[model samples]
Target: MSYLLTAPEMVATAATDLDGIAAALYAANAAAAGPTTGLLAAAEDEVSRAIATLFGAFGQEYQAVVTHAAEFHTEFTQALAAAANAYAQAEATTCSALNTFETQLQALLAPLLPNAGAGAINPPSITSIGAQVAFIMGGTGIPDPDPMYVTGAQTLFIQPRFPGFLSDALHTPEQFWPTTPNLGNLTFGRSVAEGVATLSNALTTQFSTLGNSAVVYGYSQSAVIATIEIRHLMAQVTPPSPSDLGFVLTGNPNNPNGGVLQRFTGLYVPVLDVLFNGATPPDSPYPTVIYTNQYDGTGNFPQYPLNLLADLNAVIGIVDGTHFYVGLPPDQVANAVHLPTSPGYTGNTDYFLGLTQKLPLTSLIRPIPYVGTPLAELVQPDLRVLVDLGYSDYGPGLSYADIPTPASFLSVPNPFAVSYYLAKGAAQGVQASLVNLGWLPPSYIPTGYPYAPSVAPGLNFFVGQPSVTGLSLLTGALGTAARDLGWIPPWWD
Candidate 1:
């Protein structure tokens, strides 16, 4: 990615530019000292002119004048150094001024959308199969206008709200976790779980008339929340609904607990815990696909800890059931899962499988003897763990591109800074203007368990894949929904 600003080019360019200015100043100072050179050269003229009048007297005088010229030369050299110093100072000032201007320009022009907000809705009728989606935005702290504004069009109808947190927290290396326990006393890794729950509850009552296939997608923390909520949603349905696709947690929460915030929360949930209901609500057996960015942070699950490869090989078919390695078979996945706005395919099935079902990163060490024989026997030898691209603090890469206009101003860093306030005022101002609108039918809750995979090929198959697109996933999904509803798309994107 072009994200590695640490490369030498920028530094070299800045250094060379400053040097060029200094050299120019030195040349200019030398030119300014041209009068001294002329005077020295004129010695012959002065001697010639003086000899015609008072030759002997002028000889001593001219010699004395010539002798004093060395002092002038010394002064001239000093002036050259002074000129160079001044040039350097001027260059420094110019750089500082430019930096200040850029910072202010970004502040004034830096598009920042609100991270999260709520608005009253006038329900749209669902009239088609394509419109049956229940667009669920992913986890915490992503502002409006962010890239993830166009997620989940096939499932739920959505208008993304701002997440209200810094983009760096989602993508940076700083590790911070919430104080509360998530699900089964396990400390959830990121902030989106709460946001998802909040958003889901708000929509639950309003969306009862929407369809059954609740497609939740969000990158980073939002993904984690979507996964948890899908479990909850599945549990709420009797025998579960057929439409529940669960969560598409792009950038699988870093292995072990996943996500940068794992360590702070102090909750140690194993990767195996996700497959079963240990402490969370009605246990969810629904289908979920966790997507990971190949170039994600070192906390990236499959490559985590030094012994990752050996550990998986050693844990293969262990007794604790904690280390059973498996991969999602292609038959189980829908086009919706494979064909989102962006798709990443490794082409190596075994490698994809290893990453998809590999164990989560944890501090706990499992002994070889304690593993259950059945769990050990079930381990697949063909599993291919994802290729680790080394650790990175920059999460999955997504940054603002091309400067924007009202189209641009809206793209500023925090537009939703005003969303809460604007939503309160514009609530009524925007209602009467809509002309034509598209709608889908309300959902028919399907019978049977929603948690199980829709297609069961055999014990040889698993169908979930992990892909990471960072926080843009949620922002993009929500943005698409907001545009559909006729709101000015927030500028943060």
Candidate 2:
């Protein structure tokens, strides 16, 4: 027996290219029609007339042949395009049917299968090609009304919401993580541990199968589980090769630089049952991609916690729903910034930083009627500069492991740039405030010192150097007064 494999998208693209070629040929043939088919006699003589007549007949014959060829080309192109569409539709239908069948089968078999329930692992159906991909869903506590279980009689009622973005990204069948998704303080650790075990077992089983190869995708809490699994795999004496196994993680809490876990390493909150699990292994041999969204408190936390403003902003980001990647546009996710890895780093891990256009702080403030948006615009740029200082910018060939410590207290790597931004921010703030107060016309374009002029209108503002400097001094004075009055903690720095 033999099977055929086809990529409908590739076929469609090929058809489009062929259609363009056909169009070009048709135009060329049309242009040549008049000159070739209706040739004029060079001279009013027998010889010229005879020659012209002969060539004209040949031209007409050639044109007829071309017409037949063009007709065939059109038919072929149309058939190819139709075939592509049919294939695409068939694939979609097949995937849908398979998923539905799997769900039905699991429900039917539940009663007969012992210990087969929500936590039961579904073994991968190995293909002749020997490679497979699995998608592990993120954590959630919501109970599913339409429950699909691996076993009967035992109902866990713990089915998490499946993210559409993950489905779009991974065009494959999904494998549910066999763990409780509840984030309640008492259950969080146990749920995570179960997830880790389930994933590890599934991967191990897949690897043990003859000629089997696999790639696993993990999101959110499952990403943490994946990280632990990767560590476990690496620790094995005969670990699977990069070619055999790979990993993809999104919104990973174990992200090296910005992960909340890495930021507060070794810290344990008694009631919360949250332990900073430390960073994912950057030196792992298996292929991996870790994606972190900017200002997502779990994945992208501020390095300097002492910067209270930045800390507050990060918290607001999490609260404002930046942590969720549910409805993010695919293009935005695709266009994530590729973060540079450390020099001499032999690890197969790559990091991507998803940029957030609207500051999370702005989202937090933009709901207070008329004043909300304008006030957010007025203060965002200046506040952005201050908040940004909390993060250490890694240039080319730098490690993600440069974790910030309390010893680097209030460290300003470049005082000049800081001073310049402070002045620029102050200027922008003043201009934005004036605009909000109706002192400046809406059409009046203010200078965007720290950013581009093409940035959103209200986001750009400017003021004089003297005023900016005065404002900076005033801010400093206020800070000093707060500290002296014991309003600011002594050990905060």
Candidate 3:
């Protein structure tokens, strides 16, 4: 039997390159159309007229052939793109089916198997009688000895770690460090290091002694600890399988695109005992889910600091308790948006963005009485557009929404889109404000979870509205403005 190996990513890239080639060809053909197809006799002579007519005919025939070729090229590109999508979907479906089958098979064989299942004929002598277990770790400020914090008794938010599997299962708390700040209780590094060590030992023991699978739940500071442990496990000669071990990190500062730690990777604050330890491993062997709240300063920092408005919004988010995921209702957490990963991403990691219903700007102003809410509603729509520019619309591990990212100085903003949003936002803001103030009836019934205004609007519009024209105009405008103000440098490009 013969087999064929296919890489969907390569196929997709080829299709993209072909499309570019077709576009260039089309542009070149159009430019030559008038000169090549329009016949103009050189001296009004018969021979000159004949020559021009013959060449014009040839040019027309060539154009007809080019059109057919362009059509075929477009169809081929579409087919290739579809093939890539199909292949990706097939792989995902297969993995899901296999996982489900494995779980079902384990459950069915539990009573008959000898020490092979949670309730097997000859089960291991352990406190918990389960094929899988969950470990919970608390964030900073929670005391180490507090049973509620340790055993996840009071952390109702993290109880739904793995919805179907681990919700009702045994939850073992791995609390071996001081959960307080460095200056107050223990040094931050020492505290996190201790948690990492404890969790590592616990996981190793569970795998060896109980011969069971396990999932860990980490929140805030403890999420950082989990990140460190994942790195350690990844470096091992034989790491744990995705099925055997999994991780759930909420408000993780080690998030690659937006985590505060990753935002200032090389920076360290001595007095605060905080080190920008960098991001969590994106290509870990264990199944991991990172949950980041939209504007949380710790988990989702701005990618472009030049946008001061975005920076202020993030700071407000921090003050508004956007980082606190411990008390959020289970349904709200479950409803978080699943972020998109890079194409052909084979790593065992998933990212989620928890959308903040109220704009951080609105939240900041909503403290005042009657006018506060209405006033904020009036300005939020337009202001959101400006803030959205501070982030990249499409990238690995990003949601197709108004999400934030770490600092990226090289990125340029689309000035036309900026202008469009400003106009659209102003209109929306006026309408919303009027509704809030009872001037106009509500256009849409408020669903308690109000949808924040997004640049992309939905998942289908992932590319948003950016164009070459917009970029060129923006660059030109910037240059012209700078020149007029006598601020243009000779080295400026």
Winner by lDDT: 3
Which whole-number lDDT from 0 to 100 does residue 247 have in model 2? Answer: 68
- Cα-based lDDT at residue 210, candidate 3: 46
- Candidates, ranked, lDDT: 3, 2, 1
Cα deviation of 62, candidate 3, in Å = 74
What lDDT score is found at residue 94 in candidate 3? 45
1-493 per-residue lDDT for model 3 (tens digits): 5533243444566678788988987888888888889979887889999999999999999988888888888888899889978865764564466445544554575454322211111111122344666676667654343454434422443344443334222222333234333435555665676677788888887788544777777777788889888988888987766667778787888787778776656444443456666678876767677888887877877766667888888888876878777666656677876666544555666777887767787786887899998888878766777676666543322232112233554444545345444554565566567778987555421221112643232111122212122333444455455456655322111
Alpha carbon deviation, residue 319, candidate 3 (Å) = 2.9
Q: What is the C-alpha lDDT profile of model 1 across 1-493, one tens digit per residue?
A: 2311121222333344555655665555556444433333324686665544464445446545654554455455556555555654664564466445434543453344211112112111222232234343433233231233333322211222112111211121111233322222322332343455454664364346544334444454454455456545655745334333333344334222223322111222332112111111112343344433222331132212333452343233122322211122323222212211112311111001122222222112222444332222122111121111111111011110000000000111222212222232232112211110111111211111111111111111111112222232433454455456544222111
> Which candidate, 1 or 2, has the higher lDDT?
2
Task: Please count the clashing residue pairs in each candidate, in the order shown.
Answer: 88, 2, 1
The 10 consecutive residues of candidate 2 with the worst lDDT sum are: 150-159
Sort every candidate by TM-score, greatest first: 3, 2, 1
Tens-digit per-residue lDDT, 62-88, candidate 2? 999988888888889999999989977
lDDT of each: 0.30, 0.57, 0.61
In candidate 2, stretches whose alpha carbon ends up further than 4 angstroms from where it belongs are 1-128, 140-186, 397-409, 429-493
For all predicted structures, in order, the TM-scores are: 0.27, 0.54, 0.58
Candidate 1 wrongly placed segments (more than 4 Å) = 1-131, 134-140, 143-190, 210-212, 237-240, 244-246, 254-287, 302-304, 307-493
Q: Which 10 residues in a row give candidate 1 its minimum summed lDDT?
A: 400-409
